[model samples]
Target: MSELPVLIYDGDCGFCTRSVRWAERLPVRMRILAWQEADLAAYRTTPERARHEVLWVAPSGRVFGGAAAVAELLRSARLPWPVVGWAMSAPVLRWVAERVYRWVADNRSRLPGATPACQLPPEQRPGHRHGS
Candidate 1:
Protein backbone atom coordinates (compact mmCIF):
# COMPACT_ATOMS: atom_id res chain seq x y z
CA MET A 1 0.00 0.00 0.00
CA SER A 2 2.92 2.35 -0.25
CA GLU A 3 1.98 5.38 -2.40
CA LEU A 4 5.22 5.51 -4.33
CA PRO A 5 5.92 3.84 -7.65
CA VAL A 6 7.38 0.35 -7.57
CA LEU A 7 10.18 -1.25 -9.55
CA ILE A 8 10.06 -5.03 -9.66
CA TYR A 9 13.23 -6.86 -10.58
CA ASP A 10 15.04 -10.14 -10.16
CA GLY A 11 16.67 -10.08 -6.72
CA ASP A 12 19.18 -12.81 -7.40
CA CYS A 13 20.68 -11.35 -10.57
CA GLY A 14 23.76 -9.33 -9.77
CA PHE A 15 23.59 -7.25 -12.96
CA CYS A 16 19.94 -6.53 -12.34
CA THR A 17 20.74 -5.60 -8.76
CA ARG A 18 23.34 -3.12 -9.89
CA SER A 19 20.84 -1.54 -12.28
CA VAL A 20 18.27 -1.26 -9.52
CA ARG A 21 20.78 0.30 -7.17
CA TRP A 22 21.42 2.99 -9.77
CA ALA A 23 17.71 3.60 -10.11
CA GLU A 24 17.38 3.69 -6.33
CA ARG A 25 19.80 6.60 -6.38
CA LEU A 26 17.56 8.66 -8.65
CA PRO A 27 16.27 11.98 -7.33
CA VAL A 28 12.62 10.98 -7.44
CA ARG A 29 11.43 9.13 -4.42
CA MET A 30 10.21 5.60 -5.23
CA ARG A 31 9.88 2.05 -4.01
CA ILE A 32 11.61 -1.08 -5.27
CA LEU A 33 10.87 -4.75 -4.70
CA ALA A 34 12.83 -7.75 -5.78
CA TRP A 35 10.50 -10.42 -7.17
CA GLN A 36 11.94 -12.76 -4.57
CA GLU A 37 10.99 -10.32 -1.82
CA ALA A 38 7.65 -9.03 -3.10
CA ASP A 39 4.56 -10.77 -1.82
CA LEU A 40 2.65 -11.15 -5.09
CA ALA A 41 0.28 -13.88 -4.06
CA ALA A 42 -2.79 -11.63 -4.08
CA TYR A 43 -1.97 -9.67 -7.19
CA ARG A 44 -3.12 -10.59 -10.68
CA THR A 45 0.51 -10.76 -11.74
CA THR A 46 0.78 -14.51 -12.20
CA PRO A 47 4.05 -16.28 -11.54
CA GLU A 48 4.66 -16.77 -15.26
CA ARG A 49 3.97 -13.12 -16.00
CA ALA A 50 6.12 -12.01 -13.10
CA ARG A 51 9.11 -14.04 -14.19
CA HIS A 52 9.17 -13.06 -17.86
CA GLU A 53 9.75 -9.32 -17.60
CA VAL A 54 10.47 -6.34 -15.40
CA LEU A 55 7.47 -4.43 -14.02
CA TRP A 56 6.94 -0.80 -13.17
CA VAL A 57 3.93 0.25 -11.17
CA ALA A 58 3.29 3.95 -11.13
CA PRO A 59 1.85 5.73 -8.13
CA SER A 60 -1.19 6.61 -10.24
CA GLY A 61 -1.76 2.87 -10.70
CA ARG A 62 -0.39 2.55 -14.22
CA VAL A 63 1.50 -0.64 -14.86
CA PHE A 64 4.18 -0.66 -17.55
CA GLY A 65 5.80 -3.72 -19.03
CA GLY A 66 8.87 -4.40 -21.16
CA ALA A 67 10.07 -1.27 -22.92
CA ALA A 68 7.55 0.89 -21.17
CA ALA A 69 8.94 -0.34 -17.90
CA VAL A 70 12.37 0.76 -18.99
CA ALA A 71 11.01 4.15 -19.97
CA GLU A 72 9.28 4.50 -16.65
CA LEU A 73 12.61 3.81 -15.03
CA LEU A 74 14.28 6.49 -17.10
CA ARG A 75 11.56 8.99 -16.29
CA SER A 76 12.19 8.42 -12.64
CA ALA A 77 15.88 9.08 -13.03
CA ARG A 78 17.26 12.57 -12.30
CA LEU A 79 17.03 14.66 -15.54
CA PRO A 80 18.77 14.13 -18.85
CA TRP A 81 17.76 10.54 -18.47
CA PRO A 82 14.14 11.60 -18.05
CA VAL A 83 14.37 12.95 -21.55
CA VAL A 84 15.33 9.50 -22.71
CA GLY A 85 12.11 8.18 -21.23
CA TRP A 86 10.04 10.79 -22.99
CA ALA A 87 11.75 10.04 -26.26
CA MET A 88 11.36 6.35 -25.72
CA SER A 89 7.62 6.76 -25.48
CA ALA A 90 7.38 8.23 -28.93
CA PRO A 91 5.90 5.96 -31.62
CA VAL A 92 8.98 5.48 -33.77
CA LEU A 93 11.26 5.09 -30.77
CA ARG A 94 9.11 2.50 -29.09
CA TRP A 95 9.20 0.22 -32.11
CA VAL A 96 12.93 -0.08 -31.80
CA ALA A 97 12.59 -0.57 -28.08
CA GLU A 98 10.28 -3.50 -28.63
CA ARG A 99 12.87 -5.29 -30.73
CA VAL A 100 15.55 -4.56 -28.17
CA TYR A 101 13.40 -5.95 -25.43
CA ARG A 102 12.66 -9.11 -27.40
CA TRP A 103 16.32 -9.80 -27.96
CA VAL A 104 17.06 -9.28 -24.32
CA ALA A 105 14.19 -11.50 -23.23
CA ASP A 106 15.30 -14.26 -25.56
CA ASN A 107 18.66 -14.25 -23.86
CA ARG A 108 17.58 -13.30 -20.35
CA SER A 109 18.53 -16.65 -18.94
CA ARG A 110 22.12 -15.95 -19.84
CA LEU A 111 22.25 -12.58 -18.17
CA PRO A 112 22.99 -13.99 -14.74
CA GLY A 113 21.40 -16.48 -12.46
CA ALA A 114 21.91 -20.08 -11.55
CA THR A 115 21.42 -22.30 -14.60
CA PRO A 116 23.05 -24.55 -17.16
CA ALA A 117 25.00 -22.80 -19.92
CA CYS A 118 21.70 -21.87 -21.51
CA GLN A 119 18.07 -22.77 -21.18
CA LEU A 120 17.36 -26.06 -22.98
CA PRO A 121 14.26 -27.13 -24.82
CA PRO A 122 11.84 -29.45 -23.04
CA GLU A 123 13.57 -32.35 -24.70
CA GLN A 124 16.96 -31.28 -23.36
CA ARG A 125 16.01 -29.84 -19.98
CA PRO A 126 19.01 -27.99 -18.57
CA GLY A 127 19.26 -30.12 -15.45
CA HIS A 128 20.86 -27.46 -13.30
CA ARG A 129 18.65 -25.61 -10.82
CA HIS A 130 19.74 -22.09 -11.64
CA GLY A 131 17.91 -20.14 -14.36
CA SER A 132 17.36 -16.48 -15.01
Candidate 2:
Protein backbone atom coordinates (compact mmCIF):
# COMPACT_ATOMS: atom_id res chain seq x y z
CA MET A 1 0.00 0.00 0.00
CA SER A 2 1.04 3.61 -0.48
CA GLU A 3 2.10 5.85 2.37
CA LEU A 4 -0.63 7.46 4.43
CA PRO A 5 -0.91 11.21 4.86
CA VAL A 6 0.08 12.87 8.12
CA LEU A 7 -2.38 14.82 10.26
CA ILE A 8 -0.85 17.40 12.58
CA TYR A 9 -2.77 18.83 15.53
CA ASP A 10 -2.13 20.74 18.71
CA GLY A 11 -1.21 18.34 21.51
CA ASP A 12 -1.72 20.86 24.28
CA CYS A 13 -5.30 21.59 23.30
CA GLY A 14 -7.66 19.12 24.93
CA PHE A 15 -10.31 19.62 22.30
CA CYS A 16 -7.82 19.01 19.51
CA THR A 17 -6.41 15.99 21.29
CA ARG A 18 -9.89 14.56 21.77
CA SER A 19 -10.71 15.23 18.16
CA VAL A 20 -7.63 13.29 17.11
CA ARG A 21 -8.85 10.41 19.26
CA TRP A 22 -12.16 10.52 17.46
CA ALA A 23 -10.41 10.50 14.09
CA GLU A 24 -8.47 7.45 15.17
CA ARG A 25 -11.71 5.47 15.29
CA LEU A 26 -12.26 5.90 11.58
CA PRO A 27 -11.52 2.99 9.25
CA VAL A 28 -8.99 4.99 7.27
CA ARG A 29 -5.35 4.61 8.09
CA MET A 30 -3.30 7.78 8.41
CA ARG A 31 -0.57 9.06 10.66
CA ILE A 32 -2.23 11.28 13.25
CA LEU A 33 0.52 13.06 15.12
CA ALA A 34 0.70 15.82 17.64
CA TRP A 35 2.59 18.80 16.30
CA GLN A 36 4.79 18.80 19.38
CA GLU A 37 5.96 15.28 18.55
CA ALA A 38 6.33 15.58 14.80
CA ASP A 39 9.14 17.13 12.81
CA LEU A 40 7.45 20.23 11.49
CA ALA A 41 10.19 20.75 8.93
CA ALA A 42 9.56 17.29 7.52
CA TYR A 43 5.94 18.21 6.94
CA ARG A 44 6.87 21.61 5.47
CA THR A 45 4.79 23.33 8.16
CA THR A 46 5.59 25.60 11.04
CA PRO A 47 4.71 25.58 14.73
CA GLU A 48 2.77 28.81 14.48
CA ARG A 49 0.68 27.52 11.58
CA ALA A 50 0.03 24.19 13.27
CA ARG A 51 -0.93 25.97 16.46
CA HIS A 52 -3.42 28.08 14.56
CA GLU A 53 -5.17 25.21 12.76
CA VAL A 54 -5.28 21.50 12.09
CA LEU A 55 -3.05 20.38 9.22
CA TRP A 56 -3.11 17.64 6.58
CA VAL A 57 0.24 16.87 5.04
CA ALA A 58 0.28 14.74 1.94
CA PRO A 59 3.03 12.25 1.35
CA SER A 60 4.45 14.59 -1.25
CA GLY A 61 4.83 17.34 1.37
CA ARG A 62 1.85 19.32 0.23
CA VAL A 63 -0.03 20.90 3.13
CA PHE A 64 -3.62 21.93 3.74
CA GLY A 65 -4.96 23.84 6.70
CA GLY A 66 -8.20 24.49 8.53
CA ALA A 67 -11.31 23.41 6.59
CA ALA A 68 -9.20 22.24 3.68
CA ALA A 69 -7.34 19.92 6.00
CA VAL A 70 -10.64 18.58 7.31
CA ALA A 71 -11.79 17.99 3.74
CA GLU A 72 -8.58 16.19 2.86
CA LEU A 73 -8.93 14.01 5.96
CA LEU A 74 -12.53 13.13 5.15
CA ARG A 75 -11.56 12.31 1.58
CA SER A 76 -9.25 9.66 2.93
CA ALA A 77 -11.92 7.96 4.99
CA ARG A 78 -14.19 5.06 4.05
CA LEU A 79 -17.50 5.23 2.22
CA PRO A 80 -20.06 7.99 2.92
CA TRP A 81 -17.26 10.00 4.39
CA PRO A 82 -15.50 10.50 1.06
CA VAL A 83 -18.82 11.71 -0.28
CA VAL A 84 -19.10 14.20 2.55
CA GLY A 85 -15.55 15.22 1.84
CA TRP A 86 -16.35 15.88 -1.79
CA ALA A 87 -19.28 18.00 -0.78
CA MET A 88 -17.16 20.01 1.59
CA SER A 89 -14.63 20.56 -1.16
CA ALA A 90 -17.29 21.90 -3.48
CA PRO A 91 -17.13 25.68 -4.00
CA VAL A 92 -20.10 26.83 -1.97
CA LEU A 93 -19.80 24.30 0.80
CA ARG A 94 -16.08 24.90 0.90
CA TRP A 95 -16.65 28.54 1.72
CA VAL A 96 -19.20 27.71 4.37
CA ALA A 97 -17.00 25.00 5.78
CA GLU A 98 -14.09 27.43 6.06
CA ARG A 99 -16.19 29.80 8.13
CA VAL A 100 -17.48 27.02 10.32
CA TYR A 101 -14.03 25.64 10.83
CA ARG A 102 -12.72 29.07 11.77
CA TRP A 103 -15.53 29.55 14.25
CA VAL A 104 -14.83 26.19 15.84
CA ALA A 105 -11.10 26.87 16.06
CA ASP A 106 -11.65 30.32 17.51
CA ASN A 107 -13.96 29.04 20.23
CA ARG A 108 -12.73 25.52 20.83
CA SER A 109 -11.53 26.40 24.31
CA ARG A 110 -15.15 26.81 25.29
CA LEU A 111 -16.31 23.58 23.70
CA PRO A 112 -16.75 20.23 25.38
CA GLY A 113 -13.61 18.19 26.08
CA ALA A 114 -11.60 21.42 26.02
CA THR A 115 -9.16 22.41 28.77
CA PRO A 116 -7.73 25.80 29.65
CA ALA A 117 -4.81 24.95 27.41
CA CYS A 118 -7.17 24.76 24.50
CA GLN A 119 -7.42 28.50 24.43
CA LEU A 120 -5.02 29.73 21.75
CA PRO A 121 -2.85 32.73 22.48
CA PRO A 122 -4.53 35.95 21.32
CA GLU A 123 -2.04 36.40 18.51
CA GLN A 124 -2.67 32.92 17.27
CA ARG A 125 -6.45 33.27 17.13
CA PRO A 126 -8.18 33.93 13.82
CA GLY A 127 -8.55 37.53 12.59
CA HIS A 128 -5.62 38.55 14.73
CA ARG A 129 -3.72 41.19 12.84
CA HIS A 130 -0.01 41.58 13.13
CA GLY A 131 1.28 44.84 14.63
CA SER A 132 -2.23 45.71 15.81
Candidate 3:
Protein backbone atom coordinates (compact mmCIF):
# COMPACT_ATOMS: atom_id res chain seq x y z
CA MET A 1 0.00 0.00 0.00
CA SER A 2 2.42 2.59 1.25
CA GLU A 3 5.74 3.33 -0.46
CA LEU A 4 7.69 1.63 2.28
CA PRO A 5 8.95 -1.91 2.49
CA VAL A 6 7.42 -4.12 5.17
CA LEU A 7 9.23 -6.89 6.95
CA ILE A 8 6.94 -9.44 8.54
CA TYR A 9 8.25 -11.94 11.06
CA ASP A 10 7.08 -14.23 13.84
CA GLY A 11 6.63 -12.49 17.18
CA ASP A 12 6.62 -15.69 19.21
CA CYS A 13 10.04 -16.75 17.99
CA GLY A 14 12.81 -15.25 20.11
CA PHE A 15 15.38 -15.92 17.42
CA CYS A 16 13.25 -14.27 14.76
CA THR A 17 12.55 -11.29 17.01
CA ARG A 18 16.25 -10.85 17.74
CA SER A 19 17.13 -11.13 14.05
CA VAL A 20 14.61 -8.44 13.12
CA ARG A 21 15.95 -6.17 15.83
CA TRP A 22 19.43 -6.66 14.48
CA ALA A 23 18.19 -5.79 11.01
CA GLU A 24 17.23 -2.35 12.32
CA ARG A 25 20.86 -1.29 12.04
CA LEU A 26 20.67 -1.64 8.26
CA PRO A 27 20.23 1.56 6.23
CA VAL A 28 17.02 0.44 4.59
CA ARG A 29 13.90 2.40 5.36
CA MET A 30 11.30 -0.21 6.15
CA ARG A 31 8.47 -1.06 8.48
CA ILE A 32 9.00 -4.10 10.66
CA LEU A 33 5.98 -5.79 12.20
CA ALA A 34 5.22 -9.12 13.72
CA TRP A 35 2.72 -11.11 11.67
CA GLN A 36 0.69 -11.61 14.86
CA GLU A 37 0.28 -7.83 15.08
CA ALA A 38 -0.56 -7.18 11.45
CA ASP A 39 -3.34 -8.07 9.05
CA LEU A 40 -1.54 -10.58 6.86
CA ALA A 41 -4.36 -10.79 4.32
CA ALA A 42 -3.39 -7.31 3.13
CA TYR A 43 0.05 -8.72 2.31
CA ARG A 44 -1.35 -11.80 0.59
CA THR A 45 0.02 -14.03 3.30
CA THR A 46 -1.73 -16.45 5.61
CA PRO A 47 -1.11 -16.80 9.34
CA GLU A 48 0.41 -20.22 8.80
CA ARG A 49 2.77 -18.89 6.13
CA ALA A 50 3.86 -16.02 8.32
CA ARG A 51 4.51 -18.38 11.19
CA HIS A 52 6.69 -20.55 8.99
CA GLU A 53 8.86 -17.89 7.33
CA VAL A 54 9.85 -14.25 7.25
CA LEU A 55 8.31 -12.16 4.46
CA TRP A 56 9.31 -9.00 2.67
CA VAL A 57 6.73 -6.84 0.99
CA ALA A 58 8.06 -4.26 -1.41
CA PRO A 59 6.75 -0.80 -2.11
CA SER A 60 5.64 -2.03 -5.53
CA GLY A 61 3.60 -4.82 -3.90
CA ARG A 62 6.04 -7.60 -4.62
CA VAL A 63 6.25 -10.26 -1.95
CA PHE A 64 9.28 -12.41 -1.21
CA GLY A 65 9.64 -15.25 1.24
CA GLY A 66 12.48 -17.09 2.99
CA ALA A 67 15.94 -16.57 1.49
CA ALA A 68 14.53 -14.45 -1.29
CA ALA A 69 13.04 -12.14 1.30
CA VAL A 70 16.39 -11.95 3.04
CA ALA A 71 18.01 -11.03 -0.26
CA GLU A 72 15.49 -8.28 -0.91
CA LEU A 73 16.10 -6.83 2.54
CA LEU A 74 19.83 -6.86 2.01
CA ARG A 75 19.47 -5.30 -1.42
CA SER A 76 17.70 -2.37 0.18
CA ALA A 77 20.43 -1.87 2.72
CA ARG A 78 23.55 0.24 2.22
CA LEU A 79 27.09 -0.59 1.11
CA PRO A 80 28.37 -4.10 1.69
CA TRP A 81 24.86 -5.41 2.18
CA PRO A 82 23.92 -4.81 -1.43
CA VAL A 83 26.94 -6.77 -2.53
CA VAL A 84 25.97 -9.67 -0.29
CA GLY A 85 22.45 -9.41 -1.61
CA TRP A 86 23.63 -9.66 -5.18
CA ALA A 87 25.59 -12.76 -4.34
CA MET A 88 22.63 -14.39 -2.71
CA SER A 89 20.49 -13.66 -5.75
CA ALA A 90 22.90 -15.38 -8.11
CA PRO A 91 21.40 -18.54 -9.68
CA VAL A 92 23.64 -21.19 -8.17
CA LEU A 93 24.27 -19.29 -4.96
CA ARG A 94 20.57 -18.62 -4.47
CA TRP A 95 19.91 -22.34 -4.31
CA VAL A 96 22.63 -22.88 -1.74
CA ALA A 97 21.60 -19.83 0.24
CA GLU A 98 18.03 -21.07 0.52
CA ARG A 99 19.17 -24.39 1.91
CA VAL A 100 21.46 -22.63 4.38
CA TYR A 101 18.65 -20.36 5.46
CA ARG A 102 16.38 -23.32 6.05
CA TRP A 103 19.04 -25.08 8.05
CA VAL A 104 19.58 -22.05 10.24
CA ALA A 105 15.85 -21.56 10.72
CA ASP A 106 15.44 -25.20 11.70
CA ASN A 107 18.22 -24.87 14.27
CA ARG A 108 17.42 -21.33 15.41
CA SER A 109 16.58 -22.39 18.96
CA ARG A 110 20.17 -23.52 19.42
CA LEU A 111 21.61 -20.26 18.18
CA PRO A 112 22.76 -17.31 20.22
CA GLY A 113 19.98 -14.96 21.35
CA ALA A 114 17.39 -17.71 20.98
CA THR A 115 15.12 -18.65 23.87
CA PRO A 116 13.38 -21.95 24.49
CA ALA A 117 10.28 -20.56 22.85
CA CYS A 118 12.19 -20.28 19.61
CA GLN A 119 12.46 -24.03 19.41
CA LEU A 120 9.97 -25.68 17.11
CA PRO A 121 7.76 -28.36 18.62
CA PRO A 122 9.34 -31.83 18.49
CA GLU A 123 7.03 -32.91 15.70
CA GLN A 124 7.84 -29.84 13.62
CA ARG A 125 11.57 -29.60 14.26
CA PRO A 126 13.89 -30.95 11.59
CA GLY A 127 15.54 -34.31 12.26
CA HIS A 128 13.25 -34.78 15.24
CA ARG A 129 13.71 -38.12 16.92
CA HIS A 130 10.64 -40.04 17.89
CA GLY A 131 10.96 -40.85 21.60
CA SER A 132 14.26 -41.51 23.36
Please state every model's RMSD to the true fold in angstroms.
4.8, 5.2, 6.0
Q: How many steric overlaps are in each model, in order? A: 3, 0, 0
Model 3 — which ten-residue stretch has the worst lDDT? 123-132
Ranking by lDDT: 2, 3, 1
Q: Model 3, residue 42: what's the lDDT?
A: 89
Checking candidate 1 for backbone clashes, the offending pairs are 114-130, 114-131, 115-130
Evaluate model 1: give its lDDT.
0.69
- Candidate 2 lDDT, 30-98, residue by residue in tens: 998888777787788787898789999887778999999989998999988899899999999999999
Per-residue error for 102 in candidate 1, Å, reads 2.4
Evaluate all candidate structures by whole-model CA lDDT and list the values in order: 0.69, 0.84, 0.84
